[model samples]
Target: MRRFTRNAAVAAAAAVAALGLTVTQASATSLDTWTVTPGGSFTATATNPTLTVPAATLECASSSASGTLDTGSGNPGAGIGTITTLSFTDCSVIGIDFDVTTAGSMPLNVNGVSSVANAVDGSITNIDAHVEGTACSADFTGQVTGYYKNDTKQLVINDGNLTASNADCLGVINDDDPALYEAVYAVSGGHTITLD
Candidate 1:
């Protein structure tokens, strides 16, 4: 009787395992995969944008930035990509050196095909900015508006703006009051992104 019970238990366990395998295989066929190629070189810029701070508002006369896209994969409708090689130049912030750069890839939502009206919004963190040899960092929220030109294989970031506030701009300005010590930044520019 003991031997018979042990054999029955083993058979039941094997049946359950077979059922699980069949369910997993059925679900796997229903799943869809999407592959996104690198859209090539991308660039964004801002010009003479206003930055409002707790103490005062600062205006940058000229600011420009650029980056590139990385290869990605996801579902067909819900895919994502990243921006790499981000660099900023010719930025002029009042009382602060306009030297800024991104530390990591900026994420972008990937729709079926690249469209001009598609909404691409993300945040850039660990930004490195320098003022009079003093190094500081802050996070920036960016909104990019543009279209993907299939003819030219380029992604255009036109009339885009990036804003960051509540940043501690130490040694950039002389203020005794702590409330007036914070600084804000705004940059605007239009750039063309090349997709290969």
Candidate 2:
């Protein structure tokens, strides 16, 4: 009887996977494939983007990023695209002007499609951001989780995945402090990216 039950469970799991279902952390309802329409190079902008850590908050009046995606149908895998440039303008940390930039790794991925129509979940990996202020400074590195909507053309991020490293901020922002980058970027450019 034990052997029979175990084999049945394995068969059930295999059946689910054969349906092209992405039953990972994303969502059980999310399909395992993605379709990017009119894909290519694109640019995005966000207003009032903010990065909050246990020690301090870095807020910006505006932020901009540019990247590209493949044009056509494909599976949601790593390295879907790349964010070549990302910058934050008119930023301040604790009321002090700060210069913030994203560097190192920049890959866009589509990990899952939410049950909701036109919504896709993914992340930007290897995110390295340096914050420099007159009285505070720190470097954070990690990935940012976000969901992109086709109708709104927005990528929303509000997760604490970045870890502070090489801290030198006079205790304003310490090392190993988890940082949350929250923003809603209105994506636009040559490609009208859409998922199917």
Candidate 3:
């Protein structure tokens, strides 16, 4: 496997930490653009929405990058955590819920990507999941869907619950029109959320 840039790797790592994906392989900076459908209902209180983009360019380069989800209102209560050697934990995961909705085009370089949410207290509930491998081609879609137990440090999923969705449009795209690359999405609506 080719070596990736430190910054890109760190950025990718940051996304992994935030999105909860354990990437075994590496790739170039994959671009992901999405838009929220708006008028959607969510029962989970989302906190710190995150998305990672590879630092490098192209699928052959072996780079990565990412960004966090926002309220479509240009406001993220707290920024997503960066990937580091230290096991960095989200400062306020104790009382946070998360939900996501994305629509647009995404092209990935690798075969599969993952996301994880671990419980700090070992008794609380969070969410995490890994996406299965898919062919590298246009019009492909795969979803790495699941929930984690933050307090319990465990993952509880129902039938076919761990991997909820999949498609070719899941990964990141390389070069696309500026307008096409633009993403719009939102993560909100949670019962556990407590307004300060």
Candidate 4:
């Protein structure tokens, strides 16, 4: 097996926008505060997330899943809550990151891929969080990293800094080799990405 690494700063910036996150400081006093919100239609982000596999297995459409899958923010009020969905059409690369502060450890199934429910990708770092009352708050203290490849049927995550607290209903929709969506990081503000 080989390893692929990208600049954390660059990837973070890209992934944030790709997922339709509105990066903003909590207030004037905050130096590095940011918030992620879902954007337009066709675009998909996370609020209430869900994952399901047909029967109990996921079959790859092609022989290889070693390419990159670009991500974008999904439309809001889709009745799917605040969950981001990564659709897969071609056997491309796919990875997912959750807002540690907003969404906490939620169940995940990578279909034919390996287990990542309790595993964090190594590519992600710099996460900070503190529990307040019954709620947990987190800051994007570090990068969120992971990888999803279909050829090897594997998903990798390596982060302890990020956090998520999704207690809402987990929604999972299945499609025959569906389209995979990844988080987006805005370039010089924003750009347009079509899933099809």
C-alpha RMSD by candidate, in order: 11.9, 5.0, 21.3, 19.9
Q: Each candidate's lDDT (Cα)?
A: 0.42, 0.80, 0.24, 0.26
Instruction: Report the number of the highest-TM-score candidate.
Output: 2
Total clashes for model 2: 0
Q: In candidate 1, what are the lDDT values of residues 20-59, reduced to their tens digit?
A: 9999976653353444344445554444544343444445
**Lowest-lDDT window of 10 residues in candidate 1?**
177-186
- Candidate 2, poorest ten consecutive residues by summed lDDT: 22-31
The TM-score values for the models, in the order shown, are 0.37, 0.80, 0.18, 0.19
lDDT of 3 by residue, 61-98 (tens): 11122222222332212221111111112321112321
What value does the lDDT take at residue 93 in candidate 1? 47
Clashing pairs in 1: 45-188, 45-189, 46-188, 46-189, 47-188, 116-147
**Cα-lDDT of candidate 4:** 0.26
lDDT of 1 at 94: 50
lDDT of 4 by residue, 30-88 (tens): 23211112222222222222221222211222221111222334321112111132322
Highest lDDT: which candidate? 2
Which 10 successive residues of model 3 have the least lDDT summed?
79-88
